[model samples]
Target: MLLLSRPMAPSNVVLLLIGLHGTGKSTFAKAATGQDVKVNPTGGVDAYTKECNKYTVDFKQRRFIIIDTPGMADQNTIEENLDVLQQVADQLQNLDQERVNGVIYFHSIEGARLSGVDRDNIRILKKICGDEFFPRVAFVTTRWDRIRRSEWDPILVPRNRDLETERMKLLPNGPSIFRFLNDGESHKAVLDYFAGLEDGTAANRGDKKARRSGTG
Candidate 1:
């Protein structure tokens, strides 16, 4: 079966979004891509996004191609996640500089700390992308508007610190962290970081495709 709804053009800068279930991958995708994506509300309770959805937009004279992948979790079974990963892996191999640009990893404050599934998913990501892919990854904590600074000291601060200290090892040298759905333009800031890396060329290491695990 085809993973993408439509054919990806050569000029698209593909950005893959992955995170734990309920991390608001869909919400962030909608906000960042400016596309009214259809998010399942009932069956969505588990996978939310049953399949990978691609949204294309124009940003800063460059095409912003966002691939919103299904959230990874245990409830859906390891087989389910693997199936999606296989499709993603197969698709990425065909894309060049016009392909994958970076990874946007989403986390949430609703949890007391990152869960086991979260850690497992990160491991899978590392396996697929390889160590060098770390620099292109962005670790983002979404849904920050749920609380205020006063409410964070006893709750969100320790959690955040622990994530950066231990959990962030998912990305080598620790990928840059950001607050999405909280501060305005934070999403743009991430894309901007990659944009600056352009250096008037996309043929360098900056444009190289990420490594993926063999599927099948």
Candidate 2:
């Protein structure tokens, strides 16, 4: 597994977690990196918000920087929100391109129902990052513990349909989609996904490459 074999500490790679407030971005980050994780909430960016929080974890000799930005939807203009995302992009760009890795986009499983605000925020993110950014994006639907199977099935059915429709329209050949339970079994899937990335597992490598190459 990726987590098991990960370098004692990995350096030069950073993972940014993005999502709305109450979506569990911080929680997931903590789970992924453990304690000692740095969290700098948005502060000094504007009067409305503070600077964003950045946490670092050392694993397998590599230092993984995790950045958490405030929910953009709650902010005023699309431009202002984009500015925050841009700052993140700039920071990532400054890193060694080859070493800089991925982004985990979090969404509450209980809140997966698409909303106008979500659509707008997603559009803004895609616009700023471009289509190639798809490979680096991972959608994390959290709060599984709060949902029952009966409630989940029905909700996810339509939600997945809407997501597929939107992806087909906006990102026909986008990033890989892996579901995380956000509960008891959360670590398994998430760890596997991260491991796949680290070891370049055949399935993950092939699938992501195909998507990036526009052949999938």
Clash counts per candidate, in order, are: 0, 25
Q: State the displacement of the C-alpha of residue 77, model 2, in Å, after optimal TM-score superposition.
A: 3.0
TM-score of candidate 1 to 2 decimals: 0.73
lDDT of 1: 0.61
Residue lDDT tens for model 2, 1-216 = 001122334533456677666566766666666765333333122322233566666554445666655655554466666676766555544542212355666666555465555666678756656676555556665565455667655676456445555645654544444445544345334434444556565243222332232212
Candidate lDDT values, in order: 0.61, 0.53
Model 1 CA deviation exceeding 4 Å by range: 1-11, 40-44, 76-80, 90-98, 182-184, 200-216
lDDT of 1 by residue, 82-191 (tens): 67677666655544322466777788866666676667666776776677766666677666666675766677656666766654566644444555643435566556
